[model samples]
Target chain A: MLRIAASGDWTIAHLSAADGELRSLTAGPVKAGRAVIDFSGIARFDTSSAAVLERTARLLEEKGLRVEFEGVSEPQRRLLDKIDTYGTPDTSKAPPAPFYIELVERIGVTTREIGEEARGMLGFIGTVVSAIGRTAANPRRFRLVPFVHHMEKSGFDALPLVCLLTFLIGAVVAQQGAVQLRQFGAEVFTVNLIAIIFLREVGLLLTAIIVAGRSGSAFTAEIGSMKMREEIDAMRALGLDPMEMLVIPRVAALTVTLPLLTFIADLMGLLGGGVVVFFMLDMSPGVYMSRVQEAVDFWTIAVGLIKAPFMAAVIALVGCRAGLSVTGSAESVGAMTTRSVVRSIFLVIILDALFAMFFTAVGI
Target chain B: MAQKGEPIIEVEGLMTRFGDHVIHEDLDLTVNRGEVIGIVGGSGTGKSVLLRTILGLKKPDAGRIRVFGIDLAELPEEERRLHERRWGVLFQDGALFSALTIAENIQVPYREHLHLSQELMDELAAIKIAMVGLRPTAASLYPSELSGGMRKRAGLARALALDPEILFLDEPTAGLDPIGAAAFDDLINELKEALGLTVFLVTHDLDTLHATCDRIAVLAEKHVILVGTIDDMLRSDHPWIHEYFHGPRARAALAGK
Candidate 1:
């Protein structure tokens, strides 16, 4: 028989020390035989230390020894028994895969998720298209209140920021253009450069990017939180189509507002360019205005206007789809809102590039 | 642990206010070691606020709160933390950190307070998980994945990680089904007896009060109107206390007990 004496404060405060000592005692080179763990010298006892003692006994017992407890008081025995009942917990969760295998698995999962996302987005677009068609077929079915509310929210509320940003970009462009043209003794050409860039590209591009960041994120947060709360589920349960009630109003309002905002951006950009030319080039506002008129025709101005409604529709669709796809959590809502802004901005830039190529091929 | 029947928590002339809304006024109570004390009240009587104040999460406007015979508010920061470590608290909804697994949550207090090997901590976490009646698989699962009842159990396990001498539970049975609630009551009773823990329970469930509480404290008119055993509560002639103990639901709870 092997005798082991357990002593000292066997509580949580001294748990690690006690555990280490007990483990070392069990690890010594003793033949497997009847072992007695005596606790008579123990000054204090608690469940944590009891667990260590029980674990040590079990380890010894598994190695072909009969383990017995001696000198345990009644309360201490009850605690020891309580820890014994729980036993050693099984922590046999699957180990992580090797790095290369995990990489390959992650790549496969990401590819599949992207494919599903594309299919879902296409399906959502189709639903929105049909809902718009239905509303157009019956004008009375259109929700006037929400449409107007969204128009004010996405359009009117976005006006100041869009104008301010486009105006600053226009002024910076004209100032830089004038400096470069002056080196070539053609400072007068700055007005033409400003007119062409603002009317053909910058106005609608800047406005679209701004609205995508502002209104797009708002739409996602509003709808995503509602989705998290099961309000979307409740609406579907009540037989109300979310496409008609939620998506159509927001999309249609953005489509109508983007072109109008682009027009305002174009005017603001010209006014800003005129101010810079007048101040820096010693050109009068009258001369700048006439030069702008001489540089731009209906085609240059229509190039940006034509791309407005398409980008607006894309942004609104991306935002609404992300919102509807939100799972039931605050974290998911935040992630979806961020995805809405990022995706809408990306698609707007891609759409602008496509429109630029189309207009170039058609000799616009 | 202090000797049984020794005062572990003492509150005198306590007042809690939010702006012009007074929650508690001149409230007094003493909690002895090794007792399950339940705090009960009608809606909007500040039961949770009182618990928060006692936990020092909120400062009482006017009062003295002495825990383990030390006035917590007057103690230095380092010493106050030492006193605070003697107790554990379970919030209304098991506020487990969403990012951590249940095992990691249980290990949090241990990691903060003690120096132990990773392997030992993992063993202790598994033991805690089993002690709270959770399946072994629950150790690896996140808080969001667990059901309402399982989350509460996980929260209780985390609270008990340090082997705290006192356990403060807020509405422990509020969202549980009747069967689940009864099981929880039994678990609390068992843990308290085995650990020699003083339990401060804030609950609305009459069945829980009947099954687990050693004493009941009733809150009314922004103060504790009475504190006693169930028999004393039943004998009280105060309108709210009389109606509370004689209500139809109370009758059913009493019959079940």
Candidate 2:
């Protein structure tokens, strides 16, 4: 006789232990044909156990044994009938390709997608440039109201946050510099370190990141929703230029406002550094100002200032492009808005690095 | 045959109001066992609200609802769950959980209400998927991947997971094409016969009423105005009822009759 051992409370509560006992049977030997599984010692068994029973029977059959139960309850027998009808899941569609081959295929697909995105961004840039030219040719057609509105939003609204953040960054830089320089009796040079660093890179880069997070995402969401509602198409149908009416004012405002915001951020950073110097090293404000004036070069300020328009262009273009790419779904609007902020901030840091390398190479 | 036993669901003096707006007042309904009752209404006639109140998803200002002869307010929490487990509801828009696959969606009620293993649950889900006429491969696909009709079928499969005696459908044919709607009607009729279920279908589709419902309940003003066969709906003299049954869509639907 083929022996079948069934034990424990055969339910979902005891599934792990029951399945364990069932798995152990696979490792050992069993004869082919008929087997009686005893459920006399089983305390309780439910539908979950019926599934285990079915699986156990299938496994036993694979080992060339036919299985039957000795003492199944009425309910369990009915549930067993259900399990017998459903059979097993078919995993036929699973790809049998090698792992490395699939990995390479995925990489290829992603690279092509990135290439298409880059091409689309380039096309948007060309359209924006032509739109800018058209605005320049007919200056009176420029919308002053919306331009001012955007400036107030992207610039004036950002003042308090930008000021507060830059102040803290500036303080950390001055404190760190003073700690290192004071060791060599050159604590006075902390002013030069703060001025050069903030003017050339830190203040402007931080501001760009903040603006990308705040204003860039807003631009994407605005334009994306308009596209989703078919308002952009409506504008086009009514002989309105979306580039001039929507894109131009926003881009123009960002371009003009970013430099002003950067200049203010630089001043705040200097003030923060001075406060840190005063408290930590007993450095006087008078001495700090003279040092800053001495170390502050026109090229340093011009470098950061010149980069502002380019950074603004990057934010506006990426934001608008992401918006324009939105299809019919509201989900697309959300995705594009997030992409707009992430891409703008990422490109800003990269462009800043390029500027640093170029300035150093040219010995500016 | 429908009136052979006591009503499975009974609603008496049901009143629903939102702030100053009254959606329903003194509404009464009796649904017998093993019958499909179609609810019809104009826009803002609170057909969905009545379904919600009956399902206990929404609380009315004042009412008495008896499902399976138990007062819902008096039933204890565990007992209430037991009663709830005996019924199933399909909402409009096929509210399938976005994260789970179609099969997994069907398995949810089973996982919660039954003591079944992962294998059994998976097998049962696959069975439900096929029962709803979806391809076996569709068991692994997410709700977002399915078309509108497939989504509704998946939702129906999930509703049928627990082998519920009572099925609640909200506008089941609203978004489907004419052919798909007819097929859905046939599926409902088949399932009702095969399972001996009492179906409460809130619908505006006149064709569906002719095809599937054993009785039509017309809601007007604030309460059920009429409850009878399609022939009785034709004989009703109420202005709203007269215009609705004699409307172009209704005439076209009755063309086959």
Among all candidates shown, the one with the greatest lDDT: 1
Which ranges in model 1 have alpha carbons more than 4 Å from their true place? A1-6, A21-30, A41-44, A180-183, A237-239
- lDDT tens readout by residue for model 1, A1-364: 8888988778787788777877787777667789999999898787788888899998888778999999998778888888889988676568889999999999999999989999999999888888989989998989989999999999999999998998999999999999999999999999999999999899998999999999999899988999999999999999998888899999999999999999999999988888899899989988888888899899999998999999999989998989999986788989999999999999999999999899989999
Model 2 TM-score on a 0 to 1 scale: 0.81
DockQ of 2: 0.18
Candidate 2: give the clashing pairs. Answer: A32-A64
Query: Per-residue lDDT tens digits of candidate 1, residues B1-257?
Result: 25799999999999999999999999999999999999999999999999999999999999899888888999899989877878889987789998899999998888888898777888888888988899999999999899899999999999988888889999999999999999999999989877888999999999999999999999999999999999999999999999999999999999997
Chain A alone, TM-score per model: 0.91, 0.75
Would you list the C-alpha lDDT of every candidate in the order shown?
0.91, 0.86
What is candidate 2's lDDT per residue for A1-364, written digit by digit as tens?
Answer: 6766777666554465656667687658876679888877677555446656777788788888877788876655665665566675453446679999999999999999999998988998999899889989999989999999999999999999999999999999999999999899998899999999999999899899999999999999999999999999999999999999988888999999999999999999999999999999787899888889999889989998999999998998898888888876677899999989999999999999999899899999
Candidate 2 lDDT score at position B199: 96
True interface contacts reproduced by each model, as a fraction?
0.41, 0.08
